[model samples]
Target: MIDHGLQHPVMVELLKKALVDEALASAPTDRSSTDTRIALQTGLHRKDVRRLREEPVPEGVAAPMVPMAANVVARWISEPRFLKADKTPLPLARTPRLGHPGEPDFPTLVAEVSRDVGARAVLDELLRMGVVSVSAEGMVLLKDTAFVPQEGLGDSFHFLAENVGDHLAAAAFNLSPDRQGPPLLEQSAFSSELSADQAQELQRAARRLWADVLQQFLMSATVAEQRSSSDSGPKQRVRFGVYFHQAISTPSLPAEAAQPARRHKKKPTS
Candidate 1:
């Protein structure tokens, strides 16, 4: 977290407020005032608790940030009318125009996903992020397989919150002792003694498997959405992801060896 630029003071305050909020939520109906309970549980001064409680909540607190540009890209890539024979997004005309019976141009896609936002504006944003590129013939081509924002820090942070936050929430729900239903799918495998070469091979294998599975899932979801009877019905969105990690550990190190290495003074050179 320090390497990520979240310094100690900022993290400390964030943690304190998070703990206080969780305590207040756990016992909402208790006779004690929320500020009092939060202060007691978090060991923060009552005055500080009051001040923190009154501060305006940060944007994108309760929900994940889904940028309009991302939505446009997802729909463009996933929707059947926007795809070609091989299931890849078709190169669209840079300017708006009527296409073949079912095929849609760039403007049509932008209109479908977000009518208020201009197609040119969305295209510019995508081009800036390297998600789309223009050809010499003035066609906008989808260059990215996913609608991940690659250029903006704010967008990156939002993606981090949406992806990692949901993963953690699922794990926490499964771990709760009082969980009523079957746990959401969460599983992992770990090994302590894999060589670097073996780890790289496993990483490549996992990437291939995940990519295949994700494509199938996206296609199924797109078909389902198209075939749904009620367009206005209540809807729920879900995100599933795959990750890989490999790290070295000094499990066999002696107690002294486990300690931080110290720099020793060099002997005087002759």
Candidate 2:
């Protein structure tokens, strides 16, 4: 927020307005009692509530668009045909090799993901972004597991909002008093007494595990989408993610709080 110029007061005002709006939405039919209910629920002045409701809501900023090249890289790493038996991405030939017309290659991978985008165009963008590299023999190697845009701050910010926003929303819903559905999956593993080496090892292990988990989920989701009927009901969206963070030390109580109270007699009653 300091970097983005979002100061404390601005954030507080945004939160206050959001709280008022949420309270209003939660009980739409209770509008007759809205001003009092919202004031009580959000601790906002009735005048402020009325003013906010009168003001026009600002339209949300759009999420940064991901390029087609990124999609090709994602498919390359996740699709089984493009992966080795060890589940690592296999180096792909830029074009089909002689006498292997049916072989899996870079061009075919791009075509499978999108027909309108040319394979060469996607490959060039990936190469320019340092996400992939080409060898002298025209074999393309995936340099990164994911298509993280290195040049743009907007894409990074968009992803930050998407991932963290959903995570916070899930937790908020789980803790809400009026929650009606089963809680979203929100669990983490912790080990406070870990050396730096152990933490590093765990982080690496988590990445490897995430790759497998992502692949399995994508395959399952693809099958489910193919099998489902669009006319059945409203469509749904889902996101699953994993994260690992290591700090120098685990959180602990402050020194004053951690220490026990000391007893002192009245100086021998002198």
Candidate 3:
């Protein structure tokens, strides 16, 4: 859950226009890139959207963005959550250290939060991707970031990205969870076309696409639990990292013609 703060109305509107119904929704066929659509929705020049969307995935994308966002955005966009299971009340379970922006290792914290949510594996995939960063001190921290403004961020790109990352971190960890996909990128194993640099590029590209999905979602909440909390106070500042776990590639089996058989022992004749 996120705290939307006094800018709730603005954030919601941004969600509607820039995210869900972005610019490319109406763009002519020549340019339907999601990046272009984000530009249309956010009122950002296409150049601005390009900058945010095209920025490479940061050094430690896979580590723990949600943990950092949850802590950083709490004053602006979250509620402190104690780890708990479905049949148990969170307050009755374990509570994380709160009111501190220095974040916990979300994957570990989430493992402590809810195993059914698969937050740890989801976080592992993110670390494999190289988008979010974690410090040696075990703090879940946001890396330096660039932002793409849609309708309302104005000069507040990082603030929005941080919240966006926070929201996705929750979606992947705290809220309704899914397999979050290949948390890291892999080369075209089936194809030998990828050079080392090209494979790296693919990884970076995937991370951006994932982050874009997050940006639109955070701005779209209307009556979200966390947003309601933030709206009652002065907006808090936060940083975020959008993560995507790359799909684990499955190895192909050899052709039947190429298959090898084990030698069988001959039966003795009576």
Candidate 4:
């Protein structure tokens, strides 16, 4: 068996980077002696081993509790989260065509389509992230009821990156029944429907949320890594705090009908 201990030092460092970010990241938590043994036995640079021993801890990435922390950070920085405003799953977006209502089994379908490796990983992530979660009956439930509409949590954020510029979409992947392993993953976002105002509102809401949270997120990544990680407990209290948007069929108000604006006028000699 290939003793992972003796793998490459750079490889070990990559794993360590993952562990610090909590971004589905990875790393070595073993002893330096064992690492050194593995290094020499495997002919990896002792310097690399040293780097692993002294790997700079990253922050705000939740905790290498997941995997691939670096990539997750990349995803987040490029697209924080693009919410959808539809209560329904993303595919029932029929415009003057066939009308149907259903979840469309996105999780399963995505799992199957990409052979359930990477995409399923994202699906599970959406669950763990509490964006979408598994219920008692093994059904997926939208965690945030008031997020207005359901945005494709993973898709849009990544899609925006893929479509507009020189993009290399991630490889397709799937998961096992137990849902373990590095995840065969593909991620992108899609929209169901959008009226002019709804679209505008989503944009505005996204903007506001981004403005409020982004600096904090970046700073968290930078600073949280420095302090002893004791903030998880407090952050848990913020559960259900994030919102994802989706489009819905809402009654549109005429442009004229709105909150009455108070008119200011020159008062007569009162």
Candidate 5:
């Protein structure tokens, strides 16, 4: 927020708005809560609550939490049909072959995720993001193991917000007073004493582990999506992710150096 130039007042307003929305959602739907009740819950002024309530909701501007290009890339690297025998993503033709109706290709990949969006458009986006490379013969290759976009600030920020927000949400749900079922899986490994080189090695190891985990999870999720297509019921989204961070810590004083000076026995000497 500081980088974005948002000030304390802006943060307060955002927090108040979020709290009010949460309170409203949790309240009984049969009866609408009064402005007083909302203000009490959100700690905003009654007038502010009324004004916020009356304000028109900005419409049709929301972006997807997960970009379609990302889904395409994930499918490319995870789905068996799109992967080589060695588990790496297979290079794909720009379009399906003339007679190969069921063959996996770039167009088919995008179409499976969303029919409304055209494959050409998605391909252009992936190209712009540097997620994929195209050959002179109209073949697409997955340059990155994941959709960590090298270009496009908007997509980068979108992933940052989506991943971090979901992570925090899981932690919050675990701490909620009325949480049900087992707590969402939220655990981390930490070790403070490590050389910088060791930290770098650990990060590389984490990346390798994440690659395997991502492939396994995506495969399961793809199967689940296919199985649930015919059923008419509520659906839930899940995000399982890993992050690694390392920083140098200030060195602490040794026990001998940290101890106070001992007083001399001057009186006994005299």
Candidate 6:
């Protein structure tokens, strides 16, 4: 967070408040005694705890939590009407024909996902993120299978927070004594002293594995959505993802240094 410009004091205060809220929600104490319990658990003053609970959430303080752009991208890729014989998203015409019989144009595609948001607005956002591009023939093309905001730092940060936050929550729940069923899947592999070449190969392999896993999950989700439309059953939201990370340790220098220092050659007397 420090690297991301979330400074020490701000992060400390945020974590304190977060802990207070978590304690209130997760503790076995009565609701009326929540402030005291939260204060004790979070090491915050009771008065401050009460104030935090009573105060309204400040506007614009929270990150954007909506995934409307991502939803559109998902539908575009998975919906049969929007895909070609090869199961890839078809290049759409820039303009919309209100009653076209065949595959819908770009504007119609956006409208199908959300009528409140203008197609132009969605197109601009997708273009800015490099998820979509305009073809030479004036058609809009889907450049990526996912709606990842490449150009917007704020959007990227929001994604980071949401994905990591949920993953941690799942892990924490699995660790709790009260956890009921089998724990949500969590596993990792680690090794030290790997050469740079081996690390790169592992990174590439991880990416391929993640891509395959995501494709399977997406297909299952699309099928479930279709089946739910006709079946009378309760629905639930789910998020499935994969991540990879690599950290290299810095080598320590010896007191005498690793190599002898070169002496400067004396310049010829002018």
**Best candidate (score: TM-score):** 5
Q: Per-residue lDDT for 133-229 in model 3, tens only? A: 4455444333322222222332244454555666755555433345455443212223344566766777788766654454344444322535667
Q: How well is each residue in 168-243 modelled by candidate 4, as lDDT tens digits?
A: 2123224334455575334445455588787778777776775456535544654544464655555411111233
How far residue 129's Cα lies from its native spot in candidate 5, in Å, is 1.9
Could you give candidate 1's per-residue lDDT for residues 85-195 as a string of tens digits? 877788898775534445568988888876888888888888877788999877898875677666776777778888888899899999999898999987887777889
Candidates ranked, most accurate by lDDT first:
5, 2, 1, 6, 3, 4
Model 4 segments more than 4 A misplaced: 1-103, 116-125, 135-138, 144-204, 207-270
TM-score of 2: 0.74
Q: Which runs in model 5 stand beyond 4 Å of their true positions?
A: 30-32, 59-66, 97-103, 251-270
Local accuracy by lDDT, each model = 0.78, 0.78, 0.44, 0.43, 0.83, 0.76
Q: Which ten residues in a row have the lowest lDDT in candidate 6?
A: 58-67
Best by the lDDT measure: 5
Ranking by TM-score: 5, 6, 1, 2, 3, 4
Deviation of model 3 at 180, angstroms: 22
Model 3: lDDT of residue 111: 58
lDDT of 6 by residue, 154-262 (tens): 6786778778888898899799998899898877887668898998899889876775566567778988877888876676767787777788867779967977997
Query: Cα deviation in Å at residue 204, candidate 3?
Result: 1.1
Every candidate's CA RMSD: 7.0, 4.3, 21.9, 22.9, 3.7, 8.8
> TM-score for each prediction?
0.77, 0.74, 0.24, 0.21, 0.85, 0.78
Q: Where does candidate 6 clash, by residue pair? A: none
Q: Model 3, 103: alpha-carbon shift in Å? A: 25
Number of backbone collisions per candidate: 0, 0, 28, 46, 0, 0
195, model 6: CA deviation in Å?
A: 3.4
